[model samples]
Target: MFKSGLAALIIVLLANAEAQFGVGPPFGVGPQFGVGPPFGSRPPAGFGLPSLHGDGFPGPHPRPHPFPNPRPLPPPRPLRPPRPLPPQPPQFSSLRLCTTTQLEQDKCLYALDIAGNNSIDLKLECVQTDSFDDCLQAVQTKEADLVVADEHEYLKARSADLVPLLYAHETLTSYYIAVAPKNITLLELSNATLDVNAMDERAFHAAALFNLHRGHDLCDQAAEGDVTIQIIDSADYDPTDDELLICADGSVLYAGDYDYSECNIDAGLELGIFAPRPYDTNRSFTRLLQNVFDTLINSLGQESEVWNFFSDFQGTSDVIFKNDTSGFSLIPVNRNGVTEQKFTSLHCDQVSLDH
Candidate 1:
């Protein structure tokens, strides 16, 4: 039957007309085939429809989608006006003070903190990533502001014309040598085996082989042609426990490893893998200045006293301060340009590869 017909029948039955309203009939039996529920009579059972429950009455009534949520809502209480959220710390327009390692990144941050925002609203971070060939890639990709590495590596980079923003002496202790026989020296040997390990395997090998070759050469130079030395293998040899330390009994000369420096007195071997030989000559420092010196020079023009906290460039009495007279030109100006300003820690290091 039509849907409208079914609805009409239901309405008529609900009206409770004993004499029949409009459809001429005795018991008011208007046919509403396939309509809604039966009003006067019970509906037929067992239509064989799927039921949710085993008892078969449309299974469990689908729990209300929201379960009706009939519970009374708690009354609202007077809210203490939210303490005005602490004023957001003034955000510096991000500046990229690139360096290597999150630790080095801390240098930029700490230095800025010392600079104290003096209108230099550039945030800085250090990056630990791929090689300079990759442009310290993380920074090249703008993951960091500036980047840093060994002055030697930096030299290689600079030679490529990619100069850093700053340069200053940094105390380091990274160069080290690992060997089983603790006191073996290249001068004391005809030939010996070696091993190398580092984050950059190729760079490590280059450094390793360079030092080894220089090791043999430098010994003869320092010894005035008295020492004769050669590596155990002409082909690169990996260090091993069984590796031999062929030496000339007592002619221990510096091969530039752990505990051995220009003096080459004798610091003992860094047995086993490179782990124990943490010769940090160029690694750890109170402060290391490295980067494009021009960048720091550029910061001098900003009106902010913040640059006062960075390392001083060129000379002690002079600094790179921003020129406000021309409206913020970052150039290295003498301290005479700044007024009512005090300089804080300004560590500097000189880069050298004259050797």
Candidate 2:
């Protein structure tokens, strides 16, 4: 038994010496236990052989080649010029000039601009319309600076504050004249059909003429003749040929004075330019226009044809805006207690022959 124990002890001591002399597993070895690849052998599936330097010991870790070929650095980008700023709008003094007729609008603006002589920069906004009501509305809404309209339109829109700046002086006075066979008296012509040049004007005049004799105002229903008043184009009709004709004193029929005589209907409204209420009065548009006219006259010289155009208007035709007529004078404000609607009966009942 002693001899067996001694042999077993010697075997144990040999194993311990071998382990201590570096002929055993590494200290605290983990789960990865394997022998390195043989020299010159391909590496394992994932791991690469360590890179070796001239020193012969395993040098450093093998770097991964992520791409087959690395691209060269891009050349430096070119410098760009800065962009330009946007343009600005031209500045000028602006004023709105309103007119009902195209001829008046264009000529007025041109004349005013010419009068300014480029010393006074004027940016004009023009509003041209066919209806007189629209022109008044434009001025009322402050869209227009000024307007030149007929007497009826002016009266319709006029208030205590509104006043006329200019009066288009008509040479011939307006008077309602009735022409019929010498046999018919004015009262007997009640149911008689009448032809007239201006339906609105003459109609009112007719009513007024009748009221003078009857001593009371006539409503539209009662004012109308017993027979339907046929609105005929008096331009084509001869006063002597028509059985009955009612027209203004200056109307075409008046040219044939031999055929017709005035019916003594003196009620008539003169045509004029009424400046829009307080704005026109307060802004002194009247003064401005007067100044413009004076300036034009002075700049063109008093003897220029332009002067004649303004001053030398004969009683031949209606005012021609193209001629730059400036002979307008202020008309006296005589409402004559007449309302604008008083003549609605004349125009409302008849088909608008003008349109």
Candidate 3:
């Protein structure tokens, strides 16, 4: 009777404990009735509410590392308008031309006057030198902006740093002519005496013609059966004194500008103009002068006042600014031609033998 009473009392105590803690193995085995993650235990992998750990599925949850939010970028500064550039300085207006000879000086002045009239912006000045050499020197030293020279002068000035800009066509024409005995054969003229008007003007062309005909050197001492070349003024030459006479067409033309058609002989070389190097860069100045020349040329056939200022004497005026030349043309300094080369060769150091 005493053992049965003790067992009943123990059973009643166990039942009351079950009612207090609910059904489960003691305090931490299996899931509790309605509680999550029973006590300190974890759910099975991938088999519970998401806990921000273990593949984001319900399972063991790890403490998440703290991360600060990134600071936003500063707003871009506003763009400013660009500053304006300064204006350029003004261009040169005055032009100085260096020339030789009274005719050329007068022509240059007259051309400048016409150009100045056409354009108020230009101011042309003239500096007259006694000779082509002086003109070239003035240009080289920058004492003068330009100098009008011939092919020979141009060639010489090239070594001195002179520049050839534009050709003053219909301005000046130099004709070299050879007047040999009409009936004498080249071989028979071996003993002939040749007279030249001016050594500087006619020597090369005359010698070239002589060489082309007789295949002899005009500069070397006359050999047996060779022609003797002599320099003399054309005005004093007599037909009986020399077998050959080399002269310029302008020399034959009368002072009043009349052509001596009877004196036409074998035609010769012609030389044009060579300007200073700076003229190549002075586009405005050259263009103005060129326009003035063009106007004068066009007015040649018409009854225009432009013709009155141009004193062309039988079209042989030595004035370059007037419309007297065949036409204007430009040749680069690098241009090479047989005729130009031949003419240039005659001026070589060997030319001293002619003296």
> Relative to the unseen true structure, what is the Cα RMSD of model 3?
10.8
lDDT of each residue in 37-135, candidate 2, tens digit only: 443343443453344555654556567789869999999999887888765432224446567766656555655555465454334456776666777
> What is the alpha-carbon lDDT of model 2 when measured against the actual structure?
0.48
List the candidate 3 regions with Cα displacement exceeding 4 Å.
1-47, 53-95, 101-107, 110-124, 127-134, 137-144, 169-186, 198-200, 221-271, 276-289, 296-326, 331-338, 349-355
For model 1, the stretches where C-alpha displacement exceeds 4 angstroms are 1-96, 99-107, 114-146, 151-156, 164-166, 172-188, 195-211, 214-259, 263-355
By descending lDDT, how would the candidates be arranged? 3, 2, 1
Better of 2 and 3 by TM-score: 3
Model 1, residue 190: C-alpha shift (Å): 3.0
Q: What is the TM-score of each candidate against the true structure?
A: 0.25, 0.42, 0.51
lDDT of 1 by residue, 1-355 (tens): 6999999997776565532322223344434654534544333334233334556454445565665667888999988887777544222234344443344445545556654545443344334443444444544454543444332354344444343333332122232322335344544332443333335433333223334333443222233333332322212334445333232222233232323222121111111000011111222210122222323435532333445333333333211211112221122222212111111101012233221
Tens-digit lDDT string for candidate 3 (1-355): 9999998998897687566534434433445656555654444444432344556544555656565566779999999989888654324455567778776787667665765665533355788988878877887776776666554554566766765555544322333334454345545555566555445544445444444445456355344544444543244344442244433321223223322233323223334444555556666756655553455455432344543444563455545444444445565222112255555554443423342
lDDT of each: 0.34, 0.48, 0.51
User: Higher-TM-score candidate among 1 and 3?
Assistant: 3
Better of 2 and 3 by lDDT: 3
Q: In lDDT terms, how accurate is model 1?
A: 0.34
